[model samples]
Target: MTASTAQQVVYDPYSAAFKDDPWPVYRRLRDEAPVYHSQKWGFWALSRFEDVRAAARDHETYLSFEGIDIDDTAKDMSAPGFLPDIDNPRHDQLRRIVQRTFVPRTIAKLEDDVRRVVTGLVDRFADTGTADIAQDLAWPIPYAVFFDVLGLPTTGSDREDLVRWSHGLKDREDDDPRLTPVAWDALHDTKDYLAHVLTERRAHPREDLLSTLVTAEVDDHDGVPYAPARIDRDSEIVGLAFVLFLAGVESTSALLSTAFRELARHPEQAAGLVADPAGIPAAVEEALRFDAPLQVAGRTTTRDVELHGVTIPAGERVFLVYGSANRDERQFDDPDRFDVTRPPQRHMSFSEGLHGCLGAPLARLEARVALEVALPRLGRFEISGPLTRYRSTPNMRVLDSLPVSFTPSGRTS
Candidate 1:
């Protein structure tokens, strides 16, 4: 990890090499160059735990107006209502619109519903003894739950179309930060779908979050007195729905699949969970820390900041490496090991501060319930097929497929 080796350390977030295994590069960055600059991508990165956490908390200095992805998809802020692209006082204003629905107490009420969904999914393959956990369990649970939360149509061709479009929105090219044509089509179609849903909700109001958003209002800060006004812009509303759908479905999917895959690798830990179901929550947290779904968060520095004798100029994109920071030895003991008994520690997987993930509570609940229900049924499971990574933006780390074989219970719930 000398300066020459550091210079040899090419950290390309979008490159296939980095995606295959980023931990080694992350280690090099943290050890040799704490504040590493990627000249090719024209962005600076902070890989250390403390640095990333501080930047995430300092929303003023490390502004998020540029969006959280290093890609061009949200850089210009063309996609209205993408929450990560918005800054306060508008950020806070918009967040308040749907924040209550995501609070722990509110999300807790959905436990039964989440469990039902998990049970249904797990039952589908429970008797078969072999299943692609990612496709069969991880991906669909969040889709069913979040779509229900939004009151979106989750049946027939409507659900099929939404799932297709959602997957399209996540498409990304290797070693490139630009959105693919398929992604663009998916983006347009999703917005169009949301627009149609919003219109329907307007015509026939429902008791769901989307209907609430249709009639929601916030202070119009552009005015002198800042009077309360209805959110008139359709793009803003659509943007809100879009981000929610994407984050809600994808992040949780990644979390669940990763947890299961790791558990298969560490059967002893899985055994620990089966012996004591209460440990499932801590296991979920450990999974998040060991391998975060969202790898990096992007921000723009409003002022020049000095770190590790490296100065990042004002108004440049900075990558807060959440995936790397979570594994930093400076923060966690034996950070590389996946120990279910590891002490509860704060990790940047869900991010931090004002712009922290709104759906984290729901994600945790889903993962916990998913493992709780699936593990007992999947006793002593082993990976049965080739593993594949999800083809997504550089900022994400998720499996596209995880096939597992286990002793079949010969019964379904």
Candidate 2:
């Protein structure tokens, strides 16, 4: 065994340095302490692919009951945020109610709309040959798609409110009450608005997804017929909506941004993708593997468990470092290298087991469609100015701003 360097290094997820470049720290943790214990945060972290996958699959032992975020006081576990927090059979129940809505076929129906949105977004800034892809294109695709699916009014301040609340929910700072309070407020405000929409849907059910949710029914453990209207009695229904908005918008946006940023830096790779649009799918997959959008997933041990010879006590917090796991040397060959044509392998980016991200299909679709449209329009682009990252949150690899200049292709889809 290698000499322990655990004492010489600290793994602080919130630190600016970690946010900027976490691979080195991740590499050290995987080597020296696969089951890393952070004294400051009072949690155990697993960076290896096998360990994180096992823990994610074994939900009974490593539970998400407390919350999925790193902060102990992060009350996303309460009310509408419970989708990510709750365990089965309740989690299964909630997931089942809305499962059909996000199926591949259902999501497939959005391809035309996705292309329209993507092309329009790209064309909006194509004339100038200069744009922040993150702001202009990446963020709006998922935001518009999700809004349209939910049957929400996707115009003006109402749409802006949805986007604001979606981000506010995730961007909060636990140490600073000022930063976190707005997130709490966004949660409450969005829930209230969703409730209003639910009431309106109840009175006049429509073809929209929210109406389907409001009117959907399922069977309980005892085989009793669960009331469809029971959605009105609790925040669980609203929580489901809240999660769809949060996950759909935030993660996918960050993903598109990161993928494009990488493509811009590696123009040769981007040229290859542009030359053969067929490679865009592989590129998107590589992007997910290369720079995962959401990095860490939280869990709590139900009982004492040993990992890498270290016994973590029952009820202790555990973080499944997906970002680290994706880059683990033992997992992928030349894991750090972003190869578009790497043979497809399962990655922890979308997580694993039953609690995996519900919006994975849609996220993939949004990314592929956006890249297909935008990359061609972008021609050959490069970063025009200093790139900035969103550092308010520790769980995601988000680009705050990515400035770029490109030669307009004058292409129309």
Candidate 3:
């Protein structure tokens, strides 16, 4: 843990090699530098479990007005209702507007709908001995379910445009933290579409989340004296829809695909789930900790702080490396191994504290039900084709193509 060793450890969030496998570098950061500063990106990183968790909880010290992504585009252009980019009073106000929708009880009520989506997708390929999990199952289920949750059209050109825009929003280059031209276009189009939806909802409110967003109100704490005000800002509503749609679809898809991919590698674990479908929920937690979808979250230090002999000045960007923290040996036993029966434990996959993922319950339900319905059908499946990682963003660890060869089974209801 000397300066020389620390210097040798290159922690690049935008590197192609790092994206392929970041664990080794993550380990080095935790052990050698603990508080890593990258001159290339002009940001500091916290790789250990305690440090990242602590930072996430200390929202006052680690302000989030700069958005959660380390890229320039997110920090510069973060709009209203981008929950991760807002600080409290306002953050809490906006979050409360939609919090009830994501509560466990509310999300649980959607199990039937979620299952219907999963079953339909599985039916399409369950009888076929070969299939791509990413395209055939992982990608479609979230898109269908989330779009339904928002009362958006789930078919035809509309769905196609949303899918395209989601991909475009994530487009980035290796060693570069700027959004690509495609990403910019995607962002604008997505906002435009959401704005249109909000306008429609204002004119004719429906029994949908978008309608609620357009009509919801909050206490105007930032205004002159406190008063109730309508949450009618077009940008805010659009931003809320944008984050919910993009994160809802992309993160869940990544989680589902990663779970299946890991199971394909460790057939014994897959057999465990096949034997007792009850263990599927635990399997989902393990998948999240084993390989988190979104890796790093950005924070700006509000006051000078010292950690492990490094003094980060106030107003500096800090990255809480959740992907690394989840695997910190200090927190979990045999952190590298994938075990569905690891006795449920807390992890940074969904983040922590005030900004914890609002859609977690829904994501977990979708993953558990998808596995329960699909695993038995995909008995002894093996990864048949070369696995390709998502090129959307360096922070995401998702399979773009996960072709599997399995024993064909008759379609199930």
Candidate 4:
């Protein structure tokens, strides 16, 4: 609104040559227009930490309704994971139901299980000398952990299908049509599995995430109890499950990969983290802020509102670029350089408001334990192989192969 602020803003996120690396542009947006509308995509992007934080808190103003992008595919498939893509009353109930399963105590209980899984993956790959961090370590940890949490009966079939579908969705191929009939078939099979699980829950409830959903009581806005809505037989639970697996693998793995990528680039920073193990949290925060896993989240405005002097009209679709905001100069000092000691500025990695990720605490736990286990075992891990980026990805400053060589601390007597 002010001339000084106007001087600090820029509109086009895709305009960055480093659109892949858009922090410099986000720096401008946060300084100038904390809430910026982009004409190119015909949407808005929130850049400032405060605005992003506030936007996250109030679900009423900015709704966490379902996404319609690739509507043909997602429309029939938007299964809310008790994570609430709907408005308050419904989202509130759904969120409450799901929240019950991921509490501190529940997650604390899961710590041993999660650690064992991560350690298992490390054990499998540690002796191999080197492996793709995403595929080998970061990806599978969350993939398996989510299944473990959701209480899915994974037969390895689910994972293979999920990875295939995730690749297809993330522009890994040409939307779903590339393998349309086949994609549909795989989705059908997964749905049948979930349906069987749901039915089993109906017959005999268990203490897992799906079972919770199966029996969750939906509280209407009028405070009346209603049976939880049936998960659509044809919904994107499988597709979204794929999203979660990819997210489990991609995002956390990205953090791990990028953390190593950045640390190896600046051994001094990596060395500092190793020097005092407690510092790994700060280092993780820096990794989150400097290069978050999620690049953007899409929303459709229901009413006309102005943010940072930019008017976002009702019915316009916009992307809240979390990756861009993480590097806002107004919020983070030395916006580009990865500084481990930097005070933890609020970031949009898991997003802020109503739609903020339900898996937040779990993802945080996994990543922390991962780095805790990784950095120590890594004993001066260095990128020692060909580096590549995830193809056709919209977010995540990720690498395909983060090859590293750490002093092998093996066979301790």
- Give the winner by lDDT: 1
lDDT of 2: 0.80
What digit string (tens of lDDT, one per residue) describes model 4 on residues 1-413? 67556545555533325544466677667666666654434566776766666666665666656452212333443465423346666566556756766666678778888788888878776755566676677667777788767776445776576556554444433222123454456455655566556656766878777666566565534553233335444443333333343344566667777776788788887777777879887787788777887776556666886775567777766566677767766677877888888876777788866777767778778877777776666666667877766753343356667777666567432
TM-score to true structure, per model: 0.95, 0.93, 0.95, 0.81
lDDT of 4: 0.63
Count: clashes, candidate 4: 5
lDDT tens digits by residue: candidate 2, 181-251? 76678767887788778878888989887887777665434553333454442556777776666666778
Candidate 1 per-residue lDDT over residues 101-157, each given as its tens digit: 999999999999999999999989988889999999999999999999998887899
**How far does residue 47 in candidate 1 sit from its true spot (Å)?**
0.3
The C-alpha stretches of model 4 lying farther than 4 A from their native spots are 1-19, 28-37, 66-76, 79-84, 154-159, 166-189, 220-232, 235-249, 391-398, 410-413
How far out, in Å, is residue 285 in model 2? 0.9
Candidate 3 lDDT over 60-132, as tens digits, reads 9999998787776576448877888989988998888788889999999999999898999998988888899
Which ten-residue region of model 1 has the weakest summed lDDT? 224-233
